[model samples]
Target: MKTIITSALVLGLSLSFSVSAVADDDAMMQAAGKELFNKCSACHSLDSSKNAFGPDLSGVVGRKAASLPRFAYSEALQKSDITWTEANLRKWIAGNDQFVPGTRMRHVEITDKAEQDYLIAYLKTL
Candidate 1:
């Protein structure tokens, strides 16, 4: 009976550890998204008060697709008629101009879902 109890305890501990490992993986994925954003940094700025070659993206997560003031968006993005939701942002990052057909951003695709989610989640925090 003591042996059986020990085995059950071991199993429970292993399951708990497995769950913790999965949570770690999720956290790592979010970190990967921030890494992905580095590629876009040349043109984009995270700070709302500062403008880059691209528009400032301080509140872009929930902002309209092509509604930044002063900065000129390509005719393509201007007409996308879409909002910047996580799903849509994923699609955009996978291949920006291709997805929107007229966006000025060059075609760079971040195909990993974890990376995409991480980047989108970070954007929401901005």
Candidate 2:
């Protein structure tokens, strides 16, 4: 009985440590993502619905592309029928023009996958 209890305790502690590590990793990723978002802040606003050179990205994850009524989105984007899934976001962030031809926002490609992941992580928190 004592051995079983010790084993259970060890398992519980291991699981707790794993969960904590994952949380720490997520926090670090989000922090890095926030810093990387500087590249987008000039054109995108995460705090409000106001449109700038780009539409507000306050809730962009899971949102439809070109869905903001107030913003004048490119015809291509408006018709693309895209849901901003993480995979799609990765593609869009890497190259908007390549992802959707004739996109009005001329974003420089973010080629580094890790950086893209970081930015996406930050965007998710918005």
Candidate 3:
């Protein structure tokens, strides 16, 4: 009976730890996303229908490239047939020039894959 109790306790503790770890990871990712977004804040706006130097990023996660009706996009981006999927967004952030050459916004790359993921996750919230 004591051995069974001990095993149950161990299992409970392990499950608790697993839950905690997942929560901690989520928190950390959010923090990283916020930090990374600062670099984009100068050009992009999070509010709907509000565009700064760049178009509003309020729903950018699943949005197609250069698809904001109010914002004038570069010819290169307008001509490109890129959709902002998770993989595409990751690639775009990591290397904008490579992703779309002749883009007016010449430099907008987030090289770190983890950081890119976090930023993408945060963008989905907008």
Candidate 4:
């Protein structure tokens, strides 16, 4: 009985450490992503609903494409009928032109997959 109790305690401790490690990794990824967002700040606003050259990205993760009535979106985007799923966001970040032909956003493609992952992680927090 004592051996079984010890094994259970060990398992619990291992799971706790695993969870803590994952949380730490996620926080680090989000921090990296926030740093990457500096490149986008020139044309985008993340903290508020105010639109700049691009619509505000505060709640963009699950939002529909071209949904902001105030922001004049490209015709291609308006017609794309897209939901900003993580996969779609990844493709969009990689290359907006390829993702949506004639997209007005002049964003440079983020070619690094790791960078894209980091950016997505940060975006999810918003």
Best by TM-score: 4
* lDDT of candidate 3 over 5-100, digit per residue (tens): 999999999999999999898878878898899988888877665658888887787788999888989999999888889998898889888989
Model 2 RMSD in Å is 1.6
lDDT of 1 by residue, 7-51 (tens): 999999999999999889767766776787798888888765676
**Which parts of model 4 have CA positions greater than 4 angstroms off?**
47-49
What tens digits encode model 2's per-residue C-alpha lDDT throughout 1-126? 999999999999999999999999899999999998889898887656465788999889999999987889989999999999999999998998999999999866888999988988999988
Of 2 and 3, the candidate ahead on lDDT is: 2
Q: Which residue pairs in candidate 2 collide?
A: none
What ranking of all candidate models by lDDT puts the best one first?
4, 2, 3, 1
Error of 1 at 31 (Å): 2.9
Candidate 4 lDDT tens digits, 1-126: 999999999999999999999999999999999999998888997646565898888779999999987889999999999999999999999999999999999957998999999999999888
Clash counts for all predictions? 1, 0, 0, 0
RMSD of each: 3.1, 1.6, 1.8, 1.5
lDDT by candidate, in order shown: 0.81, 0.90, 0.86, 0.91
TM-score, candidate 3, is 0.86
Models ranked on TM-score: 4, 2, 3, 1
* lDDT value, residue 66 of candidate 2: 93
Candidate 2 lDDT at 73 equals 92
User: What TM-score should be assigned to candidate 1?
Assistant: 0.73
